[model samples]
Target: MNSERDALTEILAWRRHGDPNISAVEAPVVKMVVFAVGDTLFAFPGASVTEILPMTTIYWVPGCPSSLEGVINVRGDVTSVIRLGDLLGVEHVTEDGRTAILLGHGNAMCSGLRVDRVLDVLDVLEERIQPPLSTLPERFQPWATGMFAYQGRSVLALDLGRLFQDYRAGLA
Candidate 1:
């Protein structure tokens, strides 16, 4: 089996049209970096992300869910940021050290999810995706639309709409 680095290299090459064997028949699989909240891996689609910035000042909103880290002013837009780990019921996103992903969720819903770090961006065929795992908790299961194998790793494809809905409901 190829090492993770090797797989990434090959995938990158394939994306750059370096390999003739792999033909992207459909709209090229969008690239994304998969991150972890404990053992669970979550993907942030590259297209939705506006920027990944180092931890910055966040105004805390009292009475908010523990998953909510705080609100940030990103590029003049005040965006509500949620700790990716906390929302998943995993580790707490550290305030002093972490990465904040500014995501643009269309229609002015959820603006972004703060994560620990970006793992890697890989191209995954949409056709190869399978429905979310049946073993996941029923309530949280809908947050992920499906999973796809990328560079020998299973990358969860998050449904932004479902995540937005869940978070919005949590606020109410």
Candidate 2:
């Protein structure tokens, strides 16, 4: 009984301070919110997503790019809504997109990405992500950071920073 007690104490001490011999290398993981746009599944890092809102009334902005669906009043803050399908060159399967994922990229540059549906949050190992598939349109390659399989489907991870930058450049 004393031997077992001693072993327990040793285990507790080891837990408090991890073993030095064990390589500390840990797999990189990112929390992402996966959503559907058209028939394709896409993901954005959770840190970039400020909020998820239901479809709301959007005030149209004349002369805005086709990708810009309109402006929405989010808690008195008017934010531009981007039609992700238009940007991805995919036909929106849903006539009325059901959700908007509010995304932010520093300096208060934020917008709501209209999506067909809001899926779930997933913790994805960075190594599991593969390069964008060759079959994807060339234009989409730049925005696709990587791809990974989730629940038997391929989810393309988007680089929100680059995407927003591209959008801003297009305005120039």
Candidate 3:
């Protein structure tokens, strides 16, 4: 069994470094704005994110969705912070509060998102996106536009607009 495992590892290493004919040309890197919701990591197209603000107390509004945590003052401007997990109906992200991700969707209205932490900016390519499987949880399906293999893990690419637009429309 040990020998078989060693052989498999050797073959994989060879395929990664020695297979010149099977080179997968690297994709043009685009910035990925990363954030954490609970322990899971996620990202949006960096261009879509305008700013990340520290966790601050919010002013609650009546008759809003449970996912809409509340509004925070961003440099004198009030912006609502959406609880990312609540919007997706993710139970693990049941923690009630987080920092704000002030996002502007291509000149559309700007809003804030409550996230656990903001990870570093990463660069990935369009070709790196893999289709989301139908087997994903129903709650997660609407938000996960696609998945990307970054480093050794599969990172879900979020559809920020899906979460943002409907809420903004409500305010209009």
Candidate 4:
């Protein structure tokens, strides 16, 4: 009975004062802005996404490439919108209530990425991100950095740097 009491007292004391030698290790988490282009889902680093704008009038530029959806006025700023589906060769989704513009800024430029819909904004553990699937589309493979699951659906994380770089080259 005494030994049992002593063990119980020790456990209570340990609970009151956790071991100082045990250092807490926090898992690295990446905040992401997830959106859908057609039936596929994609995400960008939250830090790169400056804003999420609602679907609005896009003033088309006559000479711009097909990937260039058009431009929109945000407050007083005019931001160019890139149709991700056109660039990545995904099935095109017409502009509708679910569409959104993710305003992302890269090293050299900033543009609004038009997506079919905005699915989620979430923090995903770094370890949760796995290498992209081999079956990924060729155009999409170049921009996909990693893949992770969100709400039972796999979401691909895109490399904003490479995407912007390619977009710049396409314009030239």
Clash tally, candidates in order: 0, 0, 0, 0
Instruction: Rank by TM-score, highest first.
Output: 4, 2, 3, 1
Provide the lDDT at 64 for model 2.
Answer: 89
How far does residue 65 in candidate 4 sit from its true spot (Å)?
A: 0.7
Tens-place lDDT per residue, model 1, 1-172, is 8456787787898777757965645565666667655555677676656666667788899997767767888778798887776666667444345454646473357566777766666676666778888886664566677787756777677766567776677631
Q: What TM-score, computed on C-alpha atoms, does each candidate reach?
A: 0.71, 0.78, 0.71, 0.82
| Candidate 3 residue 23 C-alpha distance from true site, Å | 16
TM-score of 3: 0.71
* C-alpha lDDT values of all predictions: 0.68, 0.82, 0.72, 0.87
At residue 81, candidate 2 shows an lDDT of: 89
Q: What are the per-residue Cα lDDT tens digits for candidate 4 across 37-79?
A: 8888899999889999888899999998988988999999998
Stretches of candidate 1 off by over 4 Å are: 1-28, 93-98
**Model 3 over residues 1-172: C-alpha lDDT tens digits?**
4555587787898876886667677668778877777766678888888887777878899998877778888788887777776766644343445544655464366678777777678887777778887887776776678888766666787777765765566621
If both were scored by TM-score, which would come out higher, candidate 3 or candidate 4?
A: 4
- Where is the poorest 10-residue window by lDDT in model 3? 91-100
| Model 3 bad stretches (over 4 Å) | 1-26, 92-107, 168-172
lDDT of 2 by residue, 43-109 (tens): 8888888888888888898998878988888888888889888888877767555655555563347
Candidate topping TM-score: 4
Clashing pairs in 3: none
